[model samples]
Target: MIELNPLVELIIMNFAVGLIVTISLNIEVGYLRIPQFGRLLAVIVGAVIAAAVPGRILALYLGLPYGAEYADHMYNAKIVIQINNFLSKNLLLSLAVFILTLVLAALAGGVIGYLCAYPALRLKGSYLGITLLTFGEIVTSIAWNYQPLVGGTAGVYMVNPFAFVGSGSSSLAALITLTIAISIYIYAEILARSPFVRMLKAIRDSEVASEVYGKNIVKARAQTLVIGGAIAAVAGALWATYTGRMNVASYTRLTWTFWPWAFMMLGGVGNNLGILVGVLLFTLARTAIIQYKYVITSVIPIAAEWLEYILVGLVIIFVVMFKPQGLMPEKPTLTLPRKAIEEIRKRVEQEQGRL
Candidate 1:
């Protein structure tokens, strides 16, 4: 087996997770124009579900302690080792556990999205954005203080389905995550070219006009949120699985929400390909700074920790001032068949020539 450089592995994992989350954000805020500031809500929902749910199911199957006891640090550590041993030997079971966790996470995330739609329907513009942001912060507070959900501040071990791969588990996990992220990117591209996305773009431009055209604005917004939420949750689940732990505190507004928005904005709002470009550039920049922060700080006057924030802020400001539309600005999707549009264009040109 070819060994991956540790740095390369880390970058790949970050890119995959960032891509998934940013694409989710693009679907809502970009195509649907849903000011989805509370993106972290569904992500936390996914991570919490991945953290708390799967192990219990496995415990029931194996006749081990679960629920409250499973949340205990000592019990969690001991039991997870046992589970990992079992999973490492039985590849099928490990795969099952992995799939089951993501499925549950996606479902719960979708439900949460549906619930958020109430506030979405009631509020608009910055008010709606603030409401969503508050919702995320509220969820974070609950998860941070609630022990049973994910062992609270202490955190909890996640069932590593990839443990079956032994020492190569990290590489396998990164590969799986990157594959899933790419799959979602392709799906998002197809979705962008779909009539549904066109409708979303219309509603985004003018809800009143969309409503006049018989689009159910409420239903559309709700559906968009549900889809975005489920996708984001999958990203969260993947992160939990990759790290083999559920640290609710790590799933913060800065990493999960704001970063994705910045990525989507920098990449180009409403452009999936542009999102890929943005995520790649931002992920590399962020990762490099983190990896060499101490080294860089030793030579510079700035604090190592704050360098990321300062650099990102400066970069965003530059982009906004010069490339306000993003590195790849949104382009109009073809609403008509290419051949038909060409024929019409030819007729119009001929008529103009006669005139």
Candidate 2:
């Protein structure tokens, strides 16, 4: 029986983490009218802080505040007791540090989101895209040399990847992670269905008009940005812990952030299910290419490494030219019928703000 090696399996596992973080951020930035690209920093920052904190070990021991039962089932182990035994000395302090790190990451994301509010005042679409891309690059570069901040290019280390201990089966972990990732997508779908997020689309379509109708654009934008930032940070912590590494080199420009944008765009901006399909499809494509590199090169006389960006760029071009709505257009819940569409049309006509 031909089976993939553990290393290959682990890489695939981590890719699942990347997909979740990327898609979660897409919900906020791509769909929710808050174009935030500096969020890649939140993930790394979360990972670094989570790794260095001793309390993560403690959280395992003391157990999560209320999710102990579910954690036990999900982990299929007594994680708290295991973690407690491992970090026997000063377990409370260690747990405290871990929890504190989570809070800090959340707050950091919110603050950065708030910072971008000013720039987002008159920005949307391409103008916002350029600013966000620059922010992502600048923050990523800081991760490169800001050694004192994130342990420099070497990054941080020895982070726990799971909410519990002994939960590292590559296949099972990937499946579980994928399920949670889908859950987040489901939540994003709910947000999209709600009128609250409709206001966001309004802002995306026309900020001036949304404000003209008494919507607090700044608050709405800031709320979305902060929510997206925090979600990305949670993913970051997961990524760091999964690898047991936290060096800038580990989470730099090459891997963490850019690909999510590609996945999000390819999937369809403002579409949750599309994001999932995009992540799954793109990941499968990348894996297939890597797995068949020898045959691919033999047939085409090309290097796999050199073709990385080239392939991705070509894929993006294809997305722009065709399937512009992505594999799944932002779906309408329960599939709106023609009558419902006409009703919506009338409502929109009656009061564009109402619909």
Candidate 3:
């Protein structure tokens, strides 16, 4: 068996997380046309849950209190050690807790999505986008200042679910993340081929027409946001498990929001295949920039951190200017059978003739 380098493993994990996030974004902005600029909202909810919930569960199982006192450095270290020791002795329980965290995270995200839609129902275009974005910022601010929430600025170290795997924890985490990413991609592809996706596209293309055809536009948008938000939260849960830590700073607007949007736009809006391609390209670029930052900075006048922003901005600008539809322009969605479609077309023509 070949041993993989730690850095390579980390890169693979990042790519998997990125893939999950970008695909969820695609479903909202690409297919449903929700323009969910507050992508970090769902993600942060997941991370916060992961940071707090699992630890509380473990503390309860061990008959200990769950709070900042328990989450402090010395206390947290001891708790993690005890948890790992218990997990090592109880494999099934460990797996169960891990699964439970994911479920809770997804549920929380879905509920938040539904609530967000109420404010969004009365807004459209840039107004809707700004509202969502502001909501995310407000949540982040609360998380950062409120000590009860993930220890506030101090953040909290999470108990790794894969601790039982011992030395292979990193590899196991990468494997799990990759597996989830692939599963979601397949699921999204299946959804893309379904009639439901066509409804979402219809909503995106023409809300008035879809309404005329008796479709509940608001309901459709809400459903899409709920589903997308749930999936995106799964990414955050995975990230928390992978890193074994949670911080508000880590789930930033740039990392969780703008970057995934960039991936969605670059890959080709509404194109799943394009999303995959865009994720790969951007992930690779990001990994390379991070890995070679010091070397690159030595030759360039600007700082390494700013260089990444500059390059990403340039890519977005170039893509928008030259290929606005993205690398793979969205294809027409054909949900109805040929016969049914023809009948509908004939009926439409007859109605037009009367007019």
Candidate 1 residues lying further than 4 Å off, grouped into runs, are 336-355
Q: Write the per-residue lDDT of candidate 3 for residues 208-266, one digit (tens) a residue.
A: 99899999988887888898889988999999888877777887999899999888889
Q: Pick the candidate with the highest TM-score.
A: 1
Model 3 earns a TM-score of 0.91
| Candidate 1 lDDT (Cα, 0 to 1) | 0.90
| Per-residue alpha-carbon lDDT of candidate 2 for residues 1-355, written as tens digits (9 for 90 to 100) | 2334765665556556666676667757665656555556667656655554443434444654223232223331344345544543544554455456657766776676667677776786678867866776777687667654445555434433232333343344345555655666677767778877888877777878988999987898878877777767767765554555566666654466677877877887777667777877777777777778898899889987667678788877888798777676665445578999999898888897666
- Relative to the unseen true structure, what is the C-alpha lDDT of residue 18 in candidate 3, on a scale of 0 to 100? 90
Candidate 1 per-residue lDDT over residues 184-281, each given as its tens digit: 99999999998888999999889899999999988988899999999999999999988988888788899899888888889998899999999999
Rank by TM-score, descending? 1, 3, 2
TM-score of 2: 0.73
Worst 10 residues of 2 by lDDT: 65-74
Residue-level error in angstroms, candidate 3, position 140 = 0.9
- Name every residue pair that clashes in candidate 1: none
lDDT score of residue 279 within candidate 3: 88
Better of 1 and 2 by lDDT: 1
Poorest 10 consecutive residues of model 1 by lDDT?
1-10
Instruction: Give the Cα error of residue 330 in candidate 2, in Å.
Output: 2.3
Q: What Cα-based lDDT does every candidate model obtain?
A: 0.90, 0.63, 0.85
As for lDDT, the candidate ahead, 2 or 3, is 3
Query: Which whole-number lDDT from 0 to 100 does residue 150 have in model 2?
Result: 44
